[model samples]
Target: MNLFTDFESRIKDILETLESVREKRSELDFGRVNVEPPRDPSHGDVATNAAMVLAKPLGMNPRALAELIVEKLKQDPEVTDVSVAGPGFINVRLSVSYWQKLLSGMARAGVDYGRSAVGGGRKVNVEYVSANPTGPMHVGHCRGAVVGDALANLLAFSGYEVTKEYYINDAGSQIDVLARSAFLRYRQALGEEIGEIPPGLYPGDYLVPVGEALADEFGTSLRLMPEDKWMPLVKDRTIDAMMAMIREDLAALNVNHDVFFSERTLHANGAAAIRTAINDLTFKGHVYKGTLPPPKGQLPEDWEDREQTLFRSTEVGDDIDRPLIKSDGSYTYFAADVAYFKDKFDRGFDEMIYVLGADHGGYVKRLEALARAVSGGSSKLTVLLCQLVKLFRDGEPVKMSKRSGDFVTLRDVVDEVGRDPVRFMMIYRKNSEPLDFDFAKVTEQSKDNPVFYVQYAHARCRSVFRQAADAFPDLNLESVDLASAVLGQITDPTELQLVAKLAEYPRVIEAAALAQEPHRIAFYLYDLAAAFHAHWNKGKENPELRFVNDKNRELSTARLGLVHAVASVLKSGLSITGTSAPEEMR
Candidate 1:
């Protein structure tokens, strides 16, 4: 159950009662009301702004309205205390029974306890880690991949029908470069002593296998073919091999996408789809011939003002008109993006989200304009810009890669520190903020490492349950027994504090899902883990507070049930982040 949601409803019920009692006063709308935990826990368990918001409109003094609301709320059986504070805010302390009941409900629901239906099964397409099909994924692509995967998992848990997608950048100048790069390797494979790789071509040895495969398939025949003929063949084979390598890297991090949409497909079979998308925009009067201003900053010496087929992106929300077709009559990258957006809309996705790097910040407005223009405002597109991740080892910056030569590959980090640490650390901060991932800190088995701390809390919860089973051999201690625990025995304040934190899990899931932020879950888990760990330490000082009580089996069962709830939530949260919740810390 969402405890805050329930309390909000109760508060609204009290307001409605007030409206009926004071008919002479103006009717006040409660739609904008809010119920959240107080900034100061000592003030109350939950705080509501209903009285403050409704007071002026209802022609009553704010304090007077708060008093009236408090009077009505005090009658609620679950509301043990109610007071008006700080001008008009209503502070409410729910009965201990309220939290106890929530704990029992959590045990009963287990990992499914925090699942919500706020999304209403809407179809959402989340595209991320759409790295070019030219080489292996680098560390730059790591954070976005984890963020998108975890956000997708979060949306699904919140009842959205989600499709994880990657837009394969296979139809760009970069692929031509990849083809030429592989061709050099292919020539070397066929006993030709190819000298130093050209400056623009990829020089990574990872493409050696692709070159070897091409040689095995076509022998020296490809060498004799014209550049146009062999380029296509080599590009296709090289792209496929590179995508395979990229998939392996993603798999190593436990990140996978449901759709790998190819940019080539947008212009496949004679560019029909690209033409169709541009025509649709033209018909809507959003396409026309125009010349863009020489780009800001460095004006190209060869820059010339000439007419080109342009999308009037400014008609929607873009800062300026965008080019759709180049002077050579080839569709531009933006044109292909328009077609990609159209394809996603036609696929029935009500919402489309692009997870991009911080460098793509300027692309957000144009993409948003395209979505609004293509869907005619029916579908929404949102872009999340994930900032860079700085790698560290023993407080020193870590850089360089064996795969790409210039930077670290995602596989390198995963291979060094296990997948769980990589996944958790990637999302331990907000996407827009830069993150520092330290090898030493993440691997440490201490509270300083959030990944280990949260996992340790889960492991500790399971450990206590095992201890309980051994201490009280007669107790069932099964799923049935735990759910049916006598929670009334949980009277300790520290024990209740942990229960209070658990009660907030449902609200946290709902809010995080609504905001499309997975980092919130990571932070919430760390806080919850800290609370559990603090309570556990308290037991070391007070023997009676220890969860496993040999003589007091009833209290032990209640404590075991609380521990079960904590473990269940930790597992659920970790699963969303694509991390594991170990049964044992070691």
Candidate 2:
């Protein structure tokens, strides 16, 4: 169980027993009162500001209220000591028995120890890596893909029903260009030279197979048809081919989506979905026919000076009103976005998250406004803009991949450095911060390589169990009942510190899921690995602190339980990050 959550409930119960607190119970906001690990571990096990937040509401001096809370807290059998520090902060030291029991619970839970129901089974839609189906996915899309996939995994682990989604931009003008590019390759496949790839069309050799497929299917018939007839067929075929390539690239990195929502579906049949969404917004008084003033900076390509259908986005949360339709009566790109979000809302999603690149920062406020307008302020919308990732090799900037024509394909990076390093290093830093992924650094089997280090910790944990098995052949390591194990023998300060780190796993999962930041998981795993490694090193210097004690079989078994707990946590966390926790480091 979550110790902080357990104490938070217990502390609130204690506050409710107070006559002063009961008098203002209706006005008191107990939500502000929370328990967390103390800033200084020496102070106590858990710290809370219960008295500080409840003091004024209860109409008592802060310290006086603290003393009252402390008195009630001391009555808890699990609490060994309670103290008030610096105004009204309460610190409670849990008994050693409590920690030992907690460790037993952790061991029994195994890899599922940190799984929580904090999300309450809410349906969350995470849309990421919706790259245009014109070419292979580049490294520019890698960060958001990993971040979004990990976030979805984190939310699911935290008990949320999450749907991982990808929006295919197949209905845009870019698709027409892609069709033309493929048609050129189709001609080349049919024996025409087709010398230079035009400047405007995609030049990647990746599309050559699509051309050959088209030629094999339709042969010279496509060339004889009118532009309108052939263009539609060509677009469909090329989009499918490109999406297939994209899927392979994503799979190589272990990223997959539950739904591949097509933009073409929204634009089909006279743009029915778009028109229906506009009418819904219009009925809500969120749509109007108005011209927009030229934006201060570079005017967007879709921005029109003439009167047009507009979304009154400013009425919700956007900085300026957004255009929904062009002067030619055709719907703008934002119109499709409005329809897409309405579709997600109609799907019964409680929350929608869009993981876009940093360049799309401008879309954040407008998307938030769209959610408010479309969902009528019921559904929550979040846009996480992942900053760019720069690739380097041994301190030198890595060059672009020639296979992708201009940029490094996600598959190229994954194939070169392995998927674990790519996935782990991509999220090693905050999504909002720039990440420098160095090829040489991540592959190194050193402490500096976080993925390797964390994996090594798990491998080391397994190694300890192997040593225990060899040292004591009679010991049943597999069926060692951790609940009845001699856990009290694990009294070393460093060993207890490792247990504390494991205790933070559930808290980390809940916090990261709530914040929609999976980088926190990566950061926490690295810290946990460092703690395990540090403890392992200490054992190297002091034989008595080692996990396997040949002369002390009971103590060795207890320590093995601790090692199993560490491995379980490491394996669980790595699974969430889409990385593997190896049993033995190669």
Candidate 3:
């Protein structure tokens, strides 16, 4: 159970019973009432601002209302003491018995303890890592991939029906360049002495295998076809090969998408989807024929002063109305985006989230406006912009990879430092904040390294159980119920503090999911790890604080229950972050 949520319910119930509250019941709004852990642990177990928020509406003094609420709260059997602080805030100390019982529940629930129903089964589509299908995924796509995957995991854990998606940008000019690059490789495979790649072509050696595959499939036949005839065949094959490589790279980092929507689909059948979407907008008076003023600074190459088909996006939320079709009657890239959004809305997604790189920040408002215009404000849209990750090695900048031609591939990072570190460090910072990922620091076994520290905490928890097994060979160390029965012996303040941290997991998950910030989970996990490590260090100074005591089987078992709860929460959070909780660390 969520302790803060439980206490908030209890406090609101207490407020309802007050005579003053009954008089103003019809006018009262309890939405602002919430209970959270006290900012200073020394203050109490839980803190609330119920009096401060409700007193004005009730026409009563804040401190006077707090005292009244305190009296009713004092009657709660679970609450050991209740007090008023700072004008109107209320602090309530819970009994050790209450914490002990909560610990029992936590141990019984295991890793599933933090799973929540806050999302109410809302259908959320999280689309991320839509990197162009022209090449392997580089480090630039890595951060967004992990952020989006972790976010999907977080949302699912918090009870959302989450669909992880990848949007393939295969309909652009970049794909044409890829086909031309692959054709060169195919020629080279046939013993043609092709020189250095041209300025505009992809130069990576990763396409050598694709070239070989093309030779195996088409032999010398493809070389005889004209450019237009060969272009489509080569483009399709190259996209398939590149996506296969991209998927393999993503898999190496444990990222998998439920949907891989192709941009070409929107362009298929004479742009059927794009036409339908534009028609829908036209019927709604959101489509118009207009010309856009030249953009500030250097004009874009495609800018035309002549009139064209446009979407009245500004009427919804965009900064300016956007072009749908260019002067040449070709649909713009934004047209494909509109169709993509309509496709998602038609599929009955209640919310859509786009995980894009920081460079795509300009798309945020327009995408938000599209949701309003396309869904008629029925669906919500959110854009999470992940900042660039600067790579470093021992205080020096990392050089580019020849495998990727210019940048470090996602596989390069994963293969060198490992996937867990890559995934964890990618999420350790807020997505909107630039992250400096150092190869030397993340893999270090010290507490300064968050992933290692958090993983080590889980490993230590397992070690405790192993130690307990050897200390009491006859004891059923595997029985959560058995350990839970003896939790009353775990009365130390530090032990209870760990349980208090565990109790915050559900709250953290709900808050992070609502904020759409998975970094909060990383921050919370790190804090919990620090608290656990601190307590473990205490055992060295005081023998009584040891988790597995040979002289006291009952206390040891009780502590083991506490350890189980910590491990369960750590594993749960780590799983959400797409990092493994190892059984042991070498």
Assess each prediction's global lDDT (C-alpha) against the native: 0.90, 0.92, 0.93
lDDT of 3 by residue, 274-372 (tens): 999999989999999989998888975556898999989999988888888888998888999999999999999999999999999989999999999
C-alpha RMSD of each candidate structure in angstroms: 1.8, 1.4, 1.1
At residue 28, give the lDDT of candidate 2.
91
In order of listing, the candidates' clash counts read: 0, 0, 0
lDDT of 1 by residue, 324-443 (tens): 887668778888999889999999999999999999998999999999999999999999999999999999999688678678889989999999999999999999999998999999
Q: Residue 104: error of model 3 in Å?
A: 0.9
- Best candidate per TM-score, number? 3
- Tens digits of per-residue lDDT, candidate 2, 1-586, equal 8888999999988888889888889999999998999999999888999989888877789999999989988888989999999999999998777888888889889999999999999999999999999999999899999999999999999999999999999988899999999999999999999998999999988889999999999999999999999999999899999999999999999999999999999988999999999999999999999899999988899998899999999999889999999999988999999999999999999999999999999999999999999998999999999999898999999998888888988988999999999999889988999999999999998988999999999999999989988999998876789656845877777888888888889999999998888999999999999999999999999999999989999888888888888999999999999999898977
Better of 1 and 2 by TM-score: 2
Per-prediction TM-score to the true structure, in the order listed: 0.97, 0.98, 0.98
What residue pairs clash in candidate 1, if any at all? none
Model 2 misplaced regions, further than 4 Å: none
